[model samples]
Target: MSTTPVNVQIPSDTEAPIIADFVEHALRVAYFDRQHWASLPSSDWDAPGVYILMTADGSSRVYVGQARKLRGRLQQHNNKEKLPWRRALAVKRDTTAGFNTAEIGYLEGRIAAELNALHQITVIEGQTSGDETLPKHMMISLDAFVKSILGALRLAGLDISRSNPQTLTEDEQPTSAPVPSNKPNKTVTVADLVSSGLLQAGQALFLSQAGKEAEGSVTADGEIIVRGVSYKSPSTAAAKALELQSSNGWMAWKVGSQSGPPLDMLRQQWLIQQTEEAEK
Candidate 1:
């Protein structure tokens, strides 16, 4: 529901057709003019759909679209104070005529399907799951991420969230010295892992988030469950790895038999060896 009322006004005399085309694309993908389409008695309210308006007066134009809670979305457009994307469309030519002009929505596909189908500048008060081609995780807001961070720190038994050692009741503080970092700030050269047989050709590991998924050696030494979700890790002993966005890599990633841990455990051993060697 990140909808903001955007108000970018391109002259109707010049932008009318452009608006129409934009609306047409968005109608197929992002938004719809639900009021006009669903108001009729014949319309099946239960059916998921979309509707939107295209702005044009014989020549130039603009297009505006909305979805999710159709009534609320459209109300924002009419009111010009929702998300900025909606406000941008509301000020086209005559404020009253923007919605009244040629509109399109619910032309084809389910509501989400149609909304995404249009590719229009969408203004909705809810999150739109990007298409099936995309991953499922939503972008968490900073506030939510912070809350999760606090929870994760507590779970890991780390006092990093606290301002000072005295903040704790003292029984919660660990008496042992903190573990030393084995990884040198220096980068591990690409050749290092290759020389150690950590990564094998056609090994099929995503090197990093940015790296392609083709194939790489199993150098990420860690014990990864075979049937459960496989996560990406910053280090061999990392408490948690960034969860893989694509396939359930836990099942997809394999070494010999699917029963034992992922080859990553062996890789993790290699990392531990390197860290110990560096410490010495």
Candidate 2:
């Protein structure tokens, strides 16, 4: 699948952050501060789309819902005497061609289901009217919409990929196992690249020419952390490491086998496998 670049803008220090295509749709993320909400233009509240309420303490606690009138809904949340959350993010469709109420409802359900399946985040699904029957063509658009929202959330520094314990079934739940002795293990396969930590954990990319390497790990937050520095794009990290004005980090970095394809290829394959497993 072709990848499209996302545009993220943090307009002011006090205002909420924004991620969007600029032309068609936009998502605004903000800490649930009353002052911040007050600063928002009237348009944001009047817009129709989905919103997510999450705890500010970095716990898995979250609430996901869609709102036809965002301002009113948020006001109601504010009126609650005791609420667990102090942060919220809202996704708004800017154009008339954007999501309708029914579509947003469907998107809400699908996102909730995916979060549950991924075992990520403690999702408290708010009161949604439920799924709406969408036209077959609209499904494609909805899929794209969901992708954009997920991307925006990631860019906003939210880790939606963290597994949520409440969603796990009894059989799927994790249990403590006896530790293995420090001995020679069985033959390793390609899958071992991840499980064995050669590819995913504490992995480093070597720049043979520069004789310098940067240590990093792929994080559940959908970012690559290199030398204690986190970046949403691999190329950006590579550029920083290489001290070059710009460089494609994926191509510049090599893993276990320096002679093989770049580390990005392996990472991409790993992600594909993860998606397939999640589907099952």
Candidate 3:
């Protein structure tokens, strides 16, 4: 399937309600709090769709289900005191000919399977019946629709990615590059340097370990840019390249020139300067 960007709309800045949709796929995502559930239009309740119930108290537990009547299903959930979820996200097909029970069931099953595979969040699977065969074209569309839903959830700070350990062959494993461990450096973290402004964006940095080296830079968004790839942290980049169980990127990476002092030294220097200025 072709990759396309999903458009997300936030109607109010103060509110958490969000609407994500793909103009071409007719798939729409609606995320709202429990109090705003009644604000949903009557059409959404009448439509056959999939909904995710999430805890409002910042928990990873969620309930996923398909409903022929979205409003009625949520109302039933409201009565269940055991289920402490207070927020909901729903996705539906917007078209003159709405989805049937079979189609919705298939989508619900597929979503449940994907969430289970991710193992990131606790998914409370809903009871859905029927196993209808979808056409090839419809299946492709469904796949795209699922991607949009996941993307929207991620945007909302819900991580639904697979993190399970899977065995791989030698060819499948990433090759480890040699990095140098010349002299043990002080304890300096990426966050420390960033918070102190000692490591600003667009600063050049180098990663050298196990006799291998890679050039990298800092981005405006506080991400590490290495060999044209952007990573959330230096350790992630190093781990991905070395195939190691874990890596401390700050200790392994050097700033500026290859012969320059370790990042920790720079951090220490910054700290000393801050202290001296404060004393003055």
- Per-candidate clashes come to 49, 5, 9
Deviation in Å, model 3, residue 146 alpha carbon: 1.6
Order the candidates by lDDT, highest first — what do you get? 3, 2, 1
Which portions of model 3 show Cα errors greater than 4 Å?
A: 1-3, 12-16, 57-59, 127-132, 164-280
Best by TM-score: 3
> Over the stretch 125-192, how does candidate 1's per-residue lDDT look in tens digits?
32232222211121111111222222322232322222212111211212232335654333332223
- Estimate candidate 3's alpha-carbon lDDT, on a 0 to 1 scale: 0.63
Summarize candidate 2's per-residue lDDT along 1-280 as a digit string, tens digits.
Answer: 4354655565666565443553333444443454355555566556667777667786766677777877677766767723477767777776665557888787787566545434446677544333647764554456545666766566556676632222112111112212224312232122334563446533444543365555444443234444333454556556555666555555566664455567556545544454455556
> Which candidate, 1 or 2, has the higher TM-score?
2
> In model 1, which runs have C-alpha deviations exceeding 4 angstroms?
1-179, 184-193, 204-252
Winner of 1 and 2 under lDDT: 2
For model 3, residues 1-280, the per-residue Cα lDDT tens digits are 2465678787865354577876767877788888777766775555888888888676687777888888778777777644688778887877777678877776776566556545556767543322447654454446446556666677667777655322222212122321124322233345446666877666777766776777665654445644333455567656554556656665566788677655556545555655565556
Best model number under lDDT: 3
In lDDT terms, how accurate is model 2? 0.54
Query: What are the candidates' C-alpha RMSDs?
Result: 17.7, 17.4, 15.0
> Which residue pairs show backbone clashes in model 3?
178-209, 178-210, 178-211, 178-212, 179-209, 179-210, 179-211, 180-209, 180-210
